[model samples]
Target: MRYLKVIAQDRSGKGVADTLHVEFYEGDQLQRKATEADRQRLKSFSKTYLKCAWFNSGEGEDRHVRIFSHNPSADGTPETVRLHFHEGPVIAYKAAAHDLDNDGVFELILSSDVDNDGRADRTDRNRVRSLVREFLRVGW
Candidate 1:
């Protein structure tokens, strides 16, 4: 499993000071297909949010989704969406996606700070669940 560090930012190009960690596991890394329960969970979560028709994969056919919090205080410029992706301590947003397993399936596991509160809580899990569902709906 590979890890990416995503730092949410606010308008004015300031970091939200919250680091959200996500793990990317290729199908080969997991060595298994998504379980039935996983599929159900994904379905349930995706139903809670409207289909994201405006999501831009940005020059790739890998099928992906980007989710972020709307900062009302920042005039809704999607400051949170302008995330800084890092590998270890190094910024590496350019090569963010890879077919590590060569099986064409990659799983992203959000580790913490799903709610951007700098702490793990129930809300974080739910947010992660929703994200997983949405990702599977569009990314897989």
Candidate 2:
């Protein structure tokens, strides 16, 4: 059996949670020893993160997890190790456009109730909308 200690940190490189220790002996064996730097790179390599469950701090800080362990695959079948770091809920947003004046130009309508609160508020939508709009306008 092999054991590993995975420590998660925030975008600022601050520890977010205690080290998550896990043990596994089944399935294919681990391929390599993931280091702190490797973990950081992995985290940062992710272009985007999952959205929050509901209205939150809107601080999508980059998170990194460092796995401290030793490879135990000796004379065993070569296998690959893949890791995915998800911080929030699995969600998607919807938007539409309406021509109020019927003149052809349509005003954008965005949904803010991603959490299904039954009410549309700016809490959950502003951050994402603003960021996207800014990126489109300023070419970020």
Top-TM-score structure, candidate number: 1
lDDT of 2 by residue, 1-140 (tens): 33221223243433332222222222246434445545443342222112322222223423322111112354332121212222343223433233344443333434555334466677545433432332222211
Count the clashes in each prediction: 0, 0
What is the Å distance of residue 66 in model 2 from its true position? 26
Question: Model 1 off-target regions past 4 Å?
Answer: 1-11, 14-111
Best by lDDT: 1
lDDT values for all models: 0.33, 0.31
> Which pairs, if any, clash in model 1?
none
lDDT of 2: 0.31
Q: What C-alpha lDDT, on a 0 to 100 scale, does residue 131 get in candidate 1?
A: 46
TM-score of each: 0.28, 0.24
lDDT of 1 by residue, 37-102 (tens): 555644443343222111112222122223333233444222122222233344333211222333
